[model samples]
Target: MSVVPGLVSITFRQLGVGEILALLRRTGLEAVEWGGDVHVPVGDVAAAKRTAAATADHGVRVAAYGSYYRAGDHAPADFDAVLRTAVALGAPRIRIWAGAAGSADLTTQQRAGVVGDVRRITELAAGEGVEIAVEHHPGTLTDTLDSALALYAEVGHPGLRPYWQPRLGLGPAEAVHEAGALLPGLVTVHVFSWTADGVRLALADGAPLWQPVLGTVAGASAEAGAERYALLEFVQDDDPEALVRDAVTLRSWLGGG
Candidate 1:
């Protein structure tokens, strides 16, 4: 693997198709990941097709399709559909989640089920040169890094990877620390901007965190075998330019373009 500058794969959930394509070009970012529930539902093939086409036309690379797949929910067919669309669109990564959080009964079966489905998807995606990366998201299944990693460990599938997030309601230090530790399983890192105690003008303005974040990324890069993409998934009501700035500063801090 080359020393990639941590490409920013923005989520298309908050932004529309056209706007997203335009933003990727304007920002000069190549990789993109999808969050089906956040934008176009994964089950909707028509919309997924349109989305896949648009990304291709604009010269944006589809890093992954973030799908809402519950470990307990045996829906490999559903994932197959999404993967088909993604493969057509040229995505090389697929993001799946752990079982839904707060469920009354959390069993090993739930974990095993997701592992099996993910392994199957990984095999299918590998044929298309895609990777199935598990994400650590908040307010959902496997919100924390530890729990998500446990499933990943138990599953013991080389294909099941991780997409790390710093702000799953954890402190900056904790978030950054966990993110650094999970580098081997990491595919990308979500970027966020912040003010001292309030909102900044935009996502670009979230430079405060970059100084420390770069350290985490650098250390992780050394630990991990390759330089994986440090993806920026900034969703703020503020200016999108700030979002780009947030991304740029992060790359710059990490010695990127």
Candidate 2:
């Protein structure tokens, strides 16, 4: 699979849909992952369709539907709507949170519940021709790479994949090592740069980390038979112009610049 640079709409959620599309186009990025919050709310089929149409008109791919559907956090009754929204949005995958509790803090029953919920959701998404990918984020079961692998192993579903990012607290080498370990199940990536203290930095500042991570994923995608994307999720202080530099940096990392 070919790796490409794209934008996650949530980073610029304050902007209108047309403005977001224009920003994406001007940056020469190839795709977008539309967030369910603000950009395309859940259960809003009409809005999703319209956004999908607008994105296509500008010749950009809807990489995935960035849904906030936490597996163990939301009501089971609500998942069908999320799946339907993804289908309407023309997204091949739906990005979701692993569970409400972090892996380290989960009880025995809680772990089982999270695993069962994710497995159920994966099957549900499969029926709709959409894939389920858990977000690698804090306060979720996949907060760390080991837990991410464990979650996938326990769920034991081929349809379940993970969306990885540079884990905040780890150094570049450690982060790359962790990312490499999750290569087998990684489907999407949220790209950004931040210090150990959580201060947002320029994407280019994370080059040492992103370069090897992207290279590893690019090779994995080629053998895995699907396209993978390193989406620019956040820029310095939500600045739009920073995206211009981020786009160039992303292209360079992907060897397209």
Candidate 3:
């Protein structure tokens, strides 16, 4: 399968800071994301600044900040603070997770409250010149396409988009097909490996992993003429060398170095 040109930024939430960076080096991947749980905590100003410097020092792009801040659980001030830190990191997009970590018994009104909080934060994001990407991770606010779309409709701002993750359990084809509705509002894409628990399958032995995604994004960019980033979200596997090699595979498919 042919890959779209240009390397996609990626993040490994489970990997330690140095391990993640080392994986990036080994994979030849030039862009990386900060999973707030890992390298940089959301709203941590000093850490974010240091991360920004690391991006330059390593010659890799600081793609976005992945903050697993569920909707209503976070205070408005904290949400704003996190976005501000994202800006300081020179990242244009901040990735948000939409589920409650605890309290499995959330009431309907409670869910609604989460949505409301997200709307307000998104408004702030637009005002601050940053974009918010709601990751399509289920169980939170955006567990499904309908829910995610509803959030977008409620916010009604141009700065909010989706971080699509095509997965086996989510029906990869359906995720890919349903992406049409999200194409116009997409901040970035989260590529998947054919594995369980959001792990990164090895490049060579991996299922025909990246072809379909590359074809789809290439088609979308051609139609919209919008410059978008495909984030290679390697959820696990902390080998920098392998990570960089994976980037090479993607770039070769993308028709670039």
Candidate 4:
């Protein structure tokens, strides 16, 4: 019923599974969302299982499978592979992109295509007891809060959830608003700090923005009687030490320190 502090494995994509797990043990992060693009590729059941075992050995849980299954871009059969990988990895949820195109760039039919695919994948994942989380990112239908809410409404399936992050250049007030708006269906948050121009900064440097946003997310999670994660991603300079420092800052914000 509280927000958990965790990491997105792709933050250290260059590291092997063993190395990443070892790093997790040092950071005190409670969970990891393994990236399908690298650490746990789709259909790689052997790798998924091995990583899951290693994650458990390191005393961390699999938060979700960070899959690159862009809905509407691929055939429906493709999601089956993603779902299988997530199940093998013991991930309760699979994170997917809404679509490859930006929201405004998509026509009505294209938007419908994405929505239809999302609905299909949601049902497929639910059949396996896994949920689907749409990544709230640019160059996708979820680029804006209203667009994201609308997409969810169209799907209208309990199996579909959302992952939120502070959009580039968004101020604290706007970020807080977006987080609050997504709270009802938010599954996890990709935590990071970036300048308006996309320069990664230390997590502590973004405290003014993150503090209230995290507070809002925590409140919503408690109210919904559900646990969610604030997962760290893309630290300054892609440095493991930066991740460790970010973890400390995140834990303090979550009252875990």
Q: Lowest summed-lDDT stretch of 10 residues in model 1?
A: 1-10
Estimate candidate 4's alpha-carbon lDDT, on a 0 to 1 scale. 0.92
Give the per-residue lDDT of model 2 (tens digit) for 81-174: 8998999999999999988888889998988888899999999999988889888899999887788888999999888888888766777788
For all candidates, what are the clash counts?
4, 2, 14, 0
Candidates ranked by lDDT, best first? 4, 2, 3, 1
1 or 2, greater by lDDT: 2
Off by over 4 Å in 1: 1-15, 37-59, 102-105, 139-141, 194-209, 218-225
Q: How do the predictions measure up, each by TM-score?
A: 0.76, 0.96, 0.81, 0.98
- State which candidate has the highest lDDT: 4
- The local lDDT score (0 to 100) that residue 257 gets in candidate 4 is 90
Q: Write the per-residue lDDT of candidate 4 for residues 12-104, one digit (tens) a residue.
A: 989998888888889889999999998999999999999888889889999999999999998888988899999999999999999999999
Q: lDDT tens digits, residues 109-132, model 3? A: 786787677777888887878888
Steric clash pairs (candidate 1): 6-230, 203-242, 204-242, 204-246
lDDT of each: 0.62, 0.88, 0.66, 0.92
Q: On a 0 to 1 TM-score scale, where does candidate 2 land against the true structure?
A: 0.96
Please give the distance, in angstroms, between residue 224's alpha carbon in candidate 2 and its true position after superposition: 4.5
Error of 4 at 64 (Å): 0.4
Error at 206, model 1, angstroms: 4.9
